[model samples]
Target: MRYEATRSRVEDYFDRTATKTWERLTSDAPVSKIRETVRQGRDQMRERLLARLPSDLTGRRILDAGCGTGMVTEIMAARGAEVVAVDISPQLVEIARSRLTPGLAARVTFHAGDMLSADLGRFDHVLAMDSLIYYHAHDIRNALSVLGERTQENIVFTVAPRTPLLMMMWNAGKLFPRADRSPTMIPHAPKSLSRELEDIGTLADLGRVSKGFYISQALEFRV
Candidate 1:
């Protein structure tokens, strides 16, 4: 039930509390220095994740799990990949749809629902950037197991790497009022995460990115 609980918190946070804030952060709009770091870190992480995939994605079917604003989805679609982009927040999905590139619209489908839904069908690859960061290791493993069951080639995702700085931030974030705080990020040691995922796939620590307040580690699961 941890997954469901965390998922609900995430849905609420993005759909209601921070919708506009995220919309701005993911855009070129000017933001505070703290938020700018997050924006930059996310941009770098996205490129790193995309670089792991084939450059020529023609005929590939990809699932952009937690596809916020469709940045990754759009890029993949532009490269000839048919991307099924799913986000927990309906508002975000709508924004993604509205901002989709003209011709690339046909290459992507926007869905506001669980990314793990089998109804969305199988995929050749799955990209879940910063999506699994809120869940505990067990839940992360379970989520990966579900996605892996249908994915053919690779599952690339990210986690908040356990570190002194991130730990301090995690502790400090708890001081915020319940109504204003984002869902708590549960950091994971790469080795521990890998052990939990061993039965699910061959896990690899692709790398980590840290910029000011934002920190995330890219991981690949070969199925």
Candidate 2:
């Protein structure tokens, strides 16, 4: 599928499955072992992301790109950071807004739009967790360039690793599509992301989080 078509499909899928996705990300409600394992992995990723941030985020500005259901947004707000949370799926954005208390909501400004194209102004940091796996290589570069421009300190994002085993699993998923039709996974290499940061005159700090049934890589760009 073309990039635009894939993007559209992803948006539609997320919009329709927003509730289920939220549960999968942040719920301990009874589930199969595989589903529980995936949740544990996601929790590890969240912990790693939080650990990489500054020790004190008080009064700092943050951009929570692809802030589905505001999991990271809520945590940042609790730390006294001002957050601008944006998501492409309006349904997910709505759920995020609903989850926030009035005080926490006051600390966040939500935008329902594409992170690459949004003029959300600059921030001390940008967090794009588990979101870039949907983009093609060129678009990933573009998104990183935009993020580099809008971040004053660092930009952190996760991508599915383009390893042989993971790639094979991704291909196999295409044979038996999910009923809700999840987006096609576009795995990325750490080297390609590093090169993109170099092209934009930034530094890349890469790290891996391997837990449960998932292994994701995070890239932090410093300008």
Candidate 3:
């Protein structure tokens, strides 16, 4: 119930309230100082996650779970991976599809739905960047388990690490007018998350990126 509620809130925010803002933030358009830092951090984190995958991804199948705006989708497809990019927001998914390069578009499929849906089929590698940050630990574990069951190799994901800076930012976000806030990010301690996910796979730390208000820790679940 909690997960469903959060999912609804997330979909609403991205699909209705902040579609234009997100489209701008993820693009070359100018943004505020804090958002610029976030953009930089997200770019760095995407690179970090990609580095963990095979350099030659020819013929590989990858799931870009919660692939907002499809930045990572285009990159993986360019490397010859069949990319399944899914996001909860149809508006974001449409934006992602519109931005796909000519040839690369053939290698990528865009969907607006639950990333963990069985109908999406299996994958060689799954990358869920900043996608699981809003869920509680138990929900996160369940999500990993569902993804892990169908992923043959690796499931790389990011979480909002429990840090003072992030906590402060989270609290500050709550003070915004209720109608203006996005879904609240739930921070997780690495040790606790590992414990929750131990049965799902062999967990490994892929490192973290903390730039200004954007802080996310990458973890790889080796199945």
Ranking by lDDT: 1, 3, 2
Model 1 residue 139 CA deviation (Å) reads: 0.6
* lDDT of every model, 2 decimals: 0.92, 0.79, 0.91
In candidate 2, what residue range of length 10 has the lowest lDDT sum? 19-28
Q: Which digits, one per residue and each the tens of the lDDT, describe model 1 over residues 1-223?
A: 8789899999999999889998999889999999999999999999999998999999999999999888898899999999999999999999999989989988898899999998999999999999899999999888889999999999999999999988888899999998788899898999998888787688999999989888999999985
Model 3: lDDT equals 0.91
Compute the lDDT of residue 154 as modeled in candidate 2.
Answer: 81
Off by over 4 Å in 2: 1-3, 174-181, 203-205
- The regions of model 1 sitting more than 4 angstroms off are 175-177
- Candidate 1 colliding pairs: none
**Model 2 pairs whose backbones collide:** none
What TM-score does model 3 achieve against the real structure?
0.95
Tens digit of per-residue lDDT, candidate 2, span 1-223: 4656666777887877655756455654677777677777777788788877886788899999889888899999988899999988898888888888787877899998877665788899988898888777777777777777777888888888888877897788788746645776788887876776676756455677766677788777776
